[model samples]
Target: MARNRKSVARLLIKAPVYLVAAWLLGFGFFVLTLPKAIPDGMTPKSDGIIVLTGGAGRLEAGLKLLEAKVADRMLISGVNPVVEPHELSALTGAEEALFTCCVDLDRAAPNTAGNATESNLWTQTHGYQTLVLVTADYHMPRSLILFRRAMPNATIFAYPVKGEWPMLYLANEYNKYVFTLIGEAFKPAPGDAGKQAKSATGTL
Candidate 1:
């Protein structure tokens, strides 16, 4: 009993070191795999810009890109329906016509999947074959999953917005990735939201 107790105590001491090492390795992997900068010459010629709103700086980044002529039009997903276009223009400091002409305030979507559905509709209706997806750097991976599932045929290019802090962004990216993996493993099969979004958009 005494020897067994010693062995268990030793294991407990070593367990924390192992856990710490594993976490550092996982974080390092995520950082290494993350895209350092926006890809060169990724300007989409077929479709408009689809900006998913979640991170603090995502919308501002998307608007700046639009103002720079990165794409012909912009779809700001997850917008609050009550906010007026003129209000957005005042917030962005761009002309109201810029928002009215080249932008659509999508209020239906409340998440990434919704962003895909709404943006897909906007793109298809506008006859755009290609699209540039803008979101925070940490969100690009999961965003790709939802977007690809929503718009299987459309060419998609990711234009990740720079985050405020590199460490925080990396932490968020890996945390979301792990959470999603676990959620997929144990969560019951896809239900109404995903199915309805997929069916409504017809993204087979």
Candidate 2:
């Protein structure tokens, strides 16, 4: 009986230790896989570009793509509501005409999920099917997951803004990415989403 009890205790200790080891391994893989730079000699062009705010160099990265005609139009999501077009132009050192024509602003998105939601609406409004998604490298995984959930039918490309980020910041982002992965994994496909919404509305 004592031997059996010892085996059970060993199993219990091993299980939690194994779980921690697996989690650390997964986290390390996530960090290592993050893009360090856009590969050399590779140029990605899309019909549209969407920049998620609250990241270093993300806006500038997307704006450069837009200016280079990488995409015909660009959406700068999560802009401060009070910031005017001309002011943004001055801030980015972009020509006013560019904002007037090719650039669009979304002042409502309060977070990454909101950025995806707003980008989807802008996409449908503009009829842009292919998009270049720009955000910080550490943020790319979660952003891609949310973007795919939000715009499943659209063709999306990732353009990670490379930079050396703090380890704590990276860890936080990785945890969010893991949770997002779990939360979004079972979400119904795009077609099912539409039907679910319609059914709810009908019940109402």
Off by over 4 Å in 1: 1-21, 39-42, 166-169, 181-204
Residue ranges of candidate 2 with Cα displaced over 4 Å: 1-15, 39-41, 193-204
Model 2, range 1-69, lDDT digits (tens) per residue?
Answer: 999999999999899999889889988999989976676335477889999988689878888888788
The sequence of per-residue lDDT tens digits that candidate 1 reaches over residues 4-24 is: 999999999999999889988
- After superposition on all C-alphas, the RMSD of every candidate to the true structure, in Å, is 6.0, 3.3
Task: Give the TM-scores of the predictions, in the order they appear.
Answer: 0.71, 0.85
Global Cα lDDT for candidate 1: 0.78
| lDDT against the true structure, each candidate | 0.78, 0.88
Candidate 2's TM-score: 0.85
Which residue pairs come into collision in candidate 2? none
RMSD of 1: 6.0
